[model samples]
Target: MRRGMRPLLALAVTLGASTVAHAHSVHAGLSADGRLVVSAAPAAGLTRFDPHARSPPHRLPSAGGTESTVSVLIDHAAMESGLAPSLLRAVVQQESAFNPAAVSRAGAAGLMQLMPGTARRFGVHDRFDPAQNLRGGAAYLAWLLRHFNHDTDLALAAYNAGEGSVHRHGNQIPPFAETQAYVRSVRRYEAQWIRKLRAE
Candidate 1:
């Protein structure tokens, strides 16, 4: 097995046993100050209940220059989903270049560059809504992660090109130039974000 597969397999094992504590830069949950907050659940198990009700919540930073509203939502969703925020940011950067108002030639919209059909399937009525759009996009990513057995590269490729294309090619990374480039870019960004997070 490849090196990447090892980590993914470990993650699968951990996930199978129970949800692991995800290292998140931003903490989500209820605020002690009586403000609304989104918190992460315990690392040991998956709970359908909202984790935001916990305590000692941190405020989410506002979107800044070059940071679209969708990116913020994606960040929050990643934290809430127990996924890596950097990974979400990297995917968003590759998908829409952090443009919340971006529209693909193929009719994908919002920060994550979700297609109309996909957005609908994810129950996103307003693709322009940052929170809804991020939730939809992150949910889709989570689905892809599970589908690809946590293979980040393949999952990302599928996210860009479509699962059908990947499956048609024997579950291998499709040879499409755009898809390949997208994966590489996302990986690069993921690495960068991971470094940034470690630095903090």
Candidate 2:
């Protein structure tokens, strides 16, 4: 408010220790090799935002980094399993937001969120290994697609909530809210990935 106090206030703002600043930066997106990458300085702080943007902005960065290595792996795995890479990316996005080490409270681990049993079932010895994880996830997704007669929605639901849930629901999408939301989110992300591919 006064001339003498201005320098301290300016320093506080510059150091991001003021009421309106953050001290760290968040870096996320894809690697040059097409592998998704995300890291935040442990000190990174959150900021308030405008809730009424015309288009809801991304809470976190997305795939523009285009990790080529990940892309290559997904392409090979998806093709071998007869699934689309774009769709696979969508699933990965939903499962872990591309965080290969991400683990859920339910004990699902890795980018595809493979539960311990599921990882073992798929012969994935290391769920944190992106290649192995994607391979297992892609294989399971292909199986689910086939089991559900190629119904994308049903297959996605099965991935999110388990095939048993889909079966209990008469092979339709399970009626659980989380499952439904997961399916929708995957589809939305899948479409975006598809568009990105086309643009490229």
Candidate 3:
């Protein structure tokens, strides 16, 4: 395997999948051969591998208290899902404060606070798993960005209040106080991330 295949292969191994295929580099299932194969972005020069079997239950990795490891995973998810690194960082910060096991009162779970339905839509079998959750959330965010024409505010509003709610309100941010606050918070965090990057 080429060095370019290392990232995908590592991801597959992390998920305990012998052969993993993702339409959008989010989750993994299995394949026929025992060797791990991953389908990543074509730009990465990774070959496509279709999995023939179901993946086993994932063994959850420790996200650790310092949050350093989670940050790396966030960067990876952002790259794979075509999301801005700052935006993903902000979303994760606002969503779960880097806590992989975090669960919301509204039933959102993991580092990105993914709802059950959203998680399933992104092929995330374990919501509390940081890697899976970040990838799933990043994929959803990327789709939202495209759906709303790369309007960060609108996409974030849709993330908080659902795309239907945004559409129902004429593609604008909804009037709900909580949703508004959520968008504001994410934006604030995003700004901070941007400043941090600039300073670096």
Best by lDDT: 3
| Predictions in order: lDDT | 0.63, 0.66, 0.70
Ranking by TM-score: 3, 2, 1
User: How far out, in Å, is residue 195 in model 3?
Assistant: 1.4
True-structure RMSD for candidate 1: 14.1
Off by over 4 Å in 2: 1-69
How many angstroms is residue 72 displaced in model 2 relative to the true structure, after the best TM-score fit?
1.7
* lDDT digits (tens) for residues 1-200 of candidate 1: 13223322322232222222332222222234433333344432221221112222122232232343234455568977667899998887777665444566677776677788999999987664456677889999989999999999999999999999999999999999989998999999999988976885
Q: For model 3, which pairs clash?
A: none
**How does residue 104 of candidate 3 score in lDDT?**
71
Off by over 4 Å in 3: 1-65
State each candidate's clash count.
Answer: 7, 8, 0
Arranged by lDDT, best first: 3, 2, 1
The CA lDDT at 28 in model 3 is: 30
Q: Comparing candidate 2 with candidate 3, which one achieves the higher lDDT? A: 3
TM-score on alpha carbons, each prediction? 0.65, 0.67, 0.68
Model 3 agreement with the true structure over 1-200: per-residue lDDT tens digits: 13224343444354444223233232332344435444444323232322222232221232223245456677789999998889998988888776554667777877788889999999998775567898999999999999999999999999989999999999999999999999999999999998976775
